[model samples]
Target: MKRIIITCCLLLGVTLISFAQKRVLVEAESFKDIGGWVIDQQSFDVLYSSYLMAHGMGKPVEDARTTVDFSEGGKYHVWVRTKDWAPFPTGPGEFQLSINEKPLEDSFGVSGSADWDWYYGGQVDMKKGENTLVAEDLTGFNGRFDAIYFSTEEGDVPTNDNEALLAFRKEMLNLTENAKDVGQFDLVVVGGGMAGTCAAISGARMGLKVALIQNRPVLGGNNSSEIRVHLMGRVDQNHNAKLGRIVRELDNGDPGNGNPDADRYGDERKLQIVRAEPNISLHLNTHVYEVEMDGNTIKAVIGRDIATNQEYRFEGVYFSDCTGDGTLGYLAGAEYRMGRESRAETGESLAPEEPDDFTLGTSNLWASLEREEPSDFPETPWAIQFSEEYHIDDHKADWQWETGFGNFNTIYEAEEIRDHNLRAIFGNWSYLKNEMPEKYSHHELAWVAYIGGKRESRRLMGDHVLTQMDIQDGVMYPDGSVTATWTIDLHFPDAENSKYFEGEEFFAGTKHIKVQPYTIPYRCLYSRNIDNLYMAGRDISTTHVAFGSTRVMRTCGMMGEAVGYAAYVARKNNASPREVYTLHLNEFMDIIESPLSIHNLPTLPQD
Candidate 1:
């Protein structure tokens, strides 16, 4: 056993120091068996790609294990990157570390720093051979596990700086910075959400070479299994009928917001639709972080594989910032807005009286399932305290469980906001389980979204910024292409809930100022400055008030279809997005009205 273990250790590149300390670095995402645990890439900038978060809803996920060969056999101190999520006395985010099927003396994941940092998990004897490391979740609560460092010396820990960590990761994993070239395409869509997915399909169906890059494994962004937001807003209504056939084809038929099943998002169906399109090159688990620019036009986009950390450069004639955060436009140095405008700035009533950094909050939807038997929940003293006086009575916490309004930038402070949401969910559930045990005896938390369903952020400026006046007055521009059907539904922190959890308002309230379905001008679909750049999704040109009505998934999907159609027109005319709006306006309108474009809806294969 010792001879085989030593040989295996040497063969696997396990570095060893004779008469010195040894270390074994195991990436959590590299676990051989991750069963129900999901990889979190939203914080790729901060946490890197090694982190894995457990979202068991209420049931604990199956243990995740990985085999590692020890360079030298001895007592090793283990450290894991985690946070003191729900920093109450007894944190709900609890997990146990196991080595070679034996539990570690120190129970880890119970206490960690506020940010991503290494927490000590006491020393253990490791045999000089192949051994298994397991991340055992004690509670289904959102316990995040990054990478585990089995070190001979405590001083050999990694720093929290992503750049430094990246250097360390490369050295540890033996990765190179040299990026591979992905073939050029006519159009490249940076996000795989409803907007990006629809944009890719819309362009592919038009016989254009389209490359769809998604940071996660799934196609639907917020609508994916990771986020679980229901498709809202009515499609195929009024002038927008032709624009939403793609969204309808991708719809999974679950109208409810917080369906427990991750499969409810129809991940496979969305993938199949994108796969069926020959012109569309689907790059899943690829995150586009940088853009190459030539004067004003984007030359290419650089991305990194989330799993392998391999870099890739995708070249394209045109690019779409369907990344609801306006990631591409921002990378291309295009003008954009992040928060609410001053009433004086837009001359709109809904605008804040003063210019402020207030934007609509993101949601963390969660639901409980009725179990056959009663379930016991652990005490989470580290979580936010909730009593019957401030408790919400419900089996599901839907879109209303929102946070990160006004206080933080959704793009920059994404991980923080997501952590806050997890704390809120775990904290609230702990309260319900402890205080109202009789009322919630049979209910078990089925699922809670870790990927936030963000409503507004980084609206890329376009030729024409749609305002409240445009929707209320029903002002139809000559370039009117997509019509938004949802009313002006603006979200605010619920006043009653705010009184208790100020600055951490998890409950949201919406004020719906109804308006007739109005047409959004085609000029709102592309960047105002970038020549070949196009945009869709919530990041389109719209005032904060106007976005209230247009930010729905279905509405954004239609906008994607419009952009896709425009991409085809631009390619055919050998014109830029700006030229398509300026010169080919009539041609664009004609294409939208054509039977080939409107009637041809991509459907799932009849099984």
Candidate 2:
């Protein structure tokens, strides 16, 4: 009986192998008609060849959708082909084939045209019974698909020709190796905002080696003159802390010393102060691409300079992500949360009834004016989605024009949104200054920001997430405190889509709570999972409602000082941030109070 069963098993295995040898082939007759042959809309496109023909008139297109059905428990070969001869040439294009939306291992791209049929082939799995097949174009471009043919015969397994997989692996390996070579630093500050700048300066003033990495060309992230957003925070109204003092010293001369335009100096002065720090090495236009880890501790960080195409690897004992976007903390495997939390979770009356993914939107703001000149402005050709005909002009703001309506509001994809907003802004200005010479005849385009001002992104998960209740109750911690003074300001999600104000809605929830400055706990500063990583600015752990109050730049700067000094103390005593918060609380407070002690400036107000 055992012998008979073994023989039956061997025969069944051979029968399955025979069915696996089948192949299906698809071919495109011409590049022009390749559009209908694609299977996946998200991954494929026929615009690459069209773009080459259009003299670079269009952006790369990767749109294609085609589906196939098959029985389960089988294997089949799949391939795509182009006709022997065509008017337009074919280039590189990738196809990602999947079975029942569960991606199969076999997929490849066909490049290099031929006078004869050009074919690229791979294999796919067919589950038991009926199964759906799809081939998606990963790159939007022009390509051809000929036909699909299958065979049911036993044969050896075919080799894969997927270059994309190999290329991706190689890139990851290169990044890993590069990250391992970064040099060491006593302190590394990941963000270049007001807090980050102050942190670096404070650390350097204490004689600690510091490296300040800011993603933007300018130093001030949100309050930079580039964005032109005003600074806000808890300061002695009568004698404002020389928070802007370091900046003044770097502006060739102290502009605040008597210059009437000191406040207008804004970020330029801040940039100078950071750049002038003797112990700080500034890396502007550099992005922290990845973080290297050694068990629980961060080993080093790998960064790329966008302008110079240069890479940096810095090993630091303490790292602070002031990027405001929290890039470093995210890259370092820090725990984080996005969107709004439920009232059940945070125990705040203002918390959302349920969890939500809605976040504050970023803005591409322009400072425009009612012009007195009759000069004509250039006309815009793009589509205009807002108009007074829709009653959007009722609240139409010229100087504060924003573009957060139909796109993602976070800074992760800020450049794309900024472009879209600028086009509309310039287009509207042209109509006002040139087309409507009566009402806007006196109005002129004054200034447009270089980049969109981002509101939120990845918030690092800290030891304790700051809930709206914490802010309402004025919770204080013994570790450290960063005070915030902004009201709970929430913007409507579909403001741009609304006909009432052309879709812009600013809702001050319930009523504005005018509360005295409240302190943010130190636990809200560092990642819960990451041992050596800390974050400041708007990206720190806070409920959506609480963030409405804490996201201001002035408040973020104070957070920077707290974390920066904690980092300095950690380095001096070989301690982690938690240790400094717990054991060396006094020393930490001293540093914050005398951040400019090196410059002989007055101490900060004690807690």
Candidate 3:
């Protein structure tokens, strides 16, 4: 009997493998006519794949259409991989699946399943040739799904278990197990925000072959058209005057955050500058989730194309973790810290008494425009309920329209943070339009940012963790380069906003601690343990209070410029990031002091 059972199991495995072609998987992001759906890849590091989100403010968007050609299709079971973003009872993101213009009876994204899981849409008899699939959005409030599955056999469905799901997706989509090599580079910068963009351009100008990778299609992170954050801090005050040149060139001179004019942020200017550099290879819409470590150093980093599901391997001598969450450093086993530090430990006056999980929150800003006539907005019962006394009486959502403070982590719970902001935005708008129509009757909703502008998450540890004392006293290290000019602006929950909503406050308040411009050391730009790794932007080594000043975009850009010059010095002497400071400080400083020239970089440092 045992022998017979083993034979049956072996035959079953072979049968399953042989009939794998009977099922087909269609990724939602790959749909030819996306229409009104937006590709959201922010949480791809955790979710493992990019999904489509309906980002309509309060109205249902146009249907997303795609065609599938099956080999003589008969009856196929339809399964949709989706999630209920907000489930007070029922979710707001209710959508449907339609085959050949006929809608399915089952509704998806409203199943009250918070996590990403599969939903059965019943069996349908498909035609032998091409069948058009339409994703119909019932609500305009962030309805999202990863993929759709069609199978010929019964009782055979995809698994929701992350590990098993990956294998299933690979088999169904024929995704490659081995990553294709993308050639060797002197530096691989894994972000294309202000910091990473400057790092790539500076390195290329200094004669280093560079690879700049960005998860989004655009170049800027917070300042992109998607997020609409204006450039801050004085780029001119840097100790190295040349360090700010690249930042100035990219600044679009937008006066405020969440501006309705997307062109005011200069997305094209950033992309054009990066493309002009012959030595830099910019890979947009690529998310890096894995890294190969050779002892303490990174051997190679593997990235996946968000829409296409193609994988590539990048090998480099040195790497930078500008991925604000310290994603690359965390994967490479580098030391990092999240949340606030204790006053006793760091000896900073601004720190909390005890080390707690209270970190700065994220912002999903929105804007509105004044119209001649009143515009209708749907009353959202699924959204967070707002009262006249509790709601913010404002025309536009700003940086203060933030969430995910206290226990909420900006990295792990990023999706929740963004969703919470969405609820607040819609609820406030509804109350203003429905309850008090006289004030905002002429105003219509403009652009609402789906990408959350994160303030703090994981701060990578370095040899020197710049504290409040360092910025306050102006402690000057020998390798001090970028001059941070922004005020020490630490953000927390607003007093009134928190009074109504305790743990999840959408509004923010900050107490600015004014300080003189301070020079930041190069030691804070590289990892302490990871020999070949460098860092910039918000992930750079800084205590919670000190980061308030250095976390601004212009300051982060200067840090990137310093890192680029340091990389050039390191390459000449065959040294790590630390050696560039300890062994070749003078040469690096000389390069920093010189004016930045796009075509004419100063001669090589003496051998």
Q: Output the worst ten-in-a-row residue range by lDDT, candidate 2.
A: 1-10
TM-score of each: 0.90, 0.64, 0.94
Best by lDDT: 3
Candidate 3 clashes between residue pairs 3 or more apart in a chain or in different chains: none
Worst 10 residues of 3 by lDDT: 1-10
* lDDT by residue for model 3 (1-607), tens: 0000000011111112224457777888777788899999887765667889999887889999888766666888888899999887878898988999999888899887788888888998878767888998888889999988888777777888765676666666655447778999889999888999988888888888889999999998998998888888897766677778888888878659988888988999899989988999999988888888888999888887777667778899999999899999998989999889999999998999999888889999999999988887888787888996777788798889989777577887888999999989998999888888889899999999999999999999998899999999988888888999888999989999888888879899998888888898889999999999999999999998899999999888888888888888898788999998888989988888884576686454553
For model 2, residues 1-607, the per-residue Cα lDDT tens digits are 0000000011111012223434332222112223434211101111111011110101223333334333335665543333211112333334554556766454444443432232434455666544444445543322334333333333422223223422321221122233223456788998787778877876777667789987666777656655556566554421224333333332332222112232563556676667677778888766666666887678877665432224577788888888776767766777777777888887878777898766766655554455455554544344243344532231133223444432454544453454445445544555555545666666554545435566766688888788777777776766546666777765544433443434433211224556556677878887778888878788888877888788876677767766766777777778788777778878876655555467653322222
Q: How accurate locally is residue 496 in candidate 3, as Cα lDDT from 0 to 100?
A: 92
RMSD of each: 6.3, 15.1, 5.3
Error of 2 at 267 (Å): 4.0
Score each candidate by Cα lDDT.
Answer: 0.80, 0.54, 0.84
Model 1 CA deviation exceeding 4 Å by range: 1-24, 69-78, 101-103, 121-131, 150-154, 261-264, 595-607
Q: How far off is model 1, as Cα RMSD?
A: 6.3
Runs with alpha carbons beyond 4 Å of true place in candidate 3: 1-21, 602-607
